[model samples]
Target: MSKSVNRVQKALEDLKLDATIQHMPESTRTAEDAATACKCSVGQIVKSMIFEGAETGKLKLLLVSGKHTVDLEQAAEVFGEPLIRADPKRVRSETGFAIGGVAPLGHLSATDTWMDTALLDHDLVWAAAGAPNAVFSLPPQELKDATASRIFQIG
Candidate 1:
């Protein structure tokens, strides 16, 4: 397996998540692409988004529903602070992947991660496996349990 796949596999094992990764030939870098590739609703794809917290000066992860836009104002209002979209350079520097393919956990650095409530509504969801052309489908609760992510409606 490639380095990205290996890392993702290791991450899943380390987290004790008994989920199988379903790799596809097409790129799952974007929500639209992932939805098409996985043959699922757009909302069934987990958007592992990153943001830079100006107040805390740290990286943040917002696992939002694929179909919903990341509402910055709603996020700010709920979190009581502004959440700035991270640049590609910053995201790659922190997460070891480009913007469209960053995963929720297994990041090189510590990031405050929050899973969307919409994800919990789904039986399973698709997430990037470190690369654009890679993906994994697993139970939503399994992901939340494995990642230890906070349940939030921040977006």
Candidate 2:
């Protein structure tokens, strides 16, 4: 496994999760691509998005469902401040993973994270495993617990 995959696996193990990361023959960089590769509904893919606190400059993770786009206005209201889509450098430095493969766990630092409530509708959801071509499937609630994510309405 690549270092990225290893990092994610170790993190999951450390969390005592039964999820197993699987490597794909092709890049699962986008929600559509991942859905096709995993043979699951688009809504079953978790998009680990990073946003910067407009004033604080701290990173926040948003585990959104692939089927919907985040409502920025609602997010700002919930955060009590504006949110900016983090730049690539900030994403890599803070999360230890590049764009398109940021996992919900194993971040370089502890970040405030929220998960879309819509994910709860699915029994299993797929998340990036610290690499674009690697992913893991786990129960949505289990993932929420493992990542310490607060469930929220994203869109």
lDDT, candidate 2, 93-119, per-residue tens: 878999998998888789999899999
Candidate 1 has an lDDT of: 0.82
Cα error of candidate 2 at position 40, Å: 0.4
Q: How does model 2 score by TM-score? A: 0.96
lDDT of each: 0.82, 0.90
Q: Put down candidate 1 lDDT per residue, 1-155, tens digits, no spaces.
A: 66666778789888877766677888888899999999999999999988887687678888888987777867766555788878789888878777876877677877788888899889889898887877888899988877778888743
Off by over 4 Å in 1: none
In candidate 1, list every pair of residues with a backbone clash: none
> For model 1, what is the alpha-carbon lDDT of residue 45?
94
Clashing pairs in 2: none
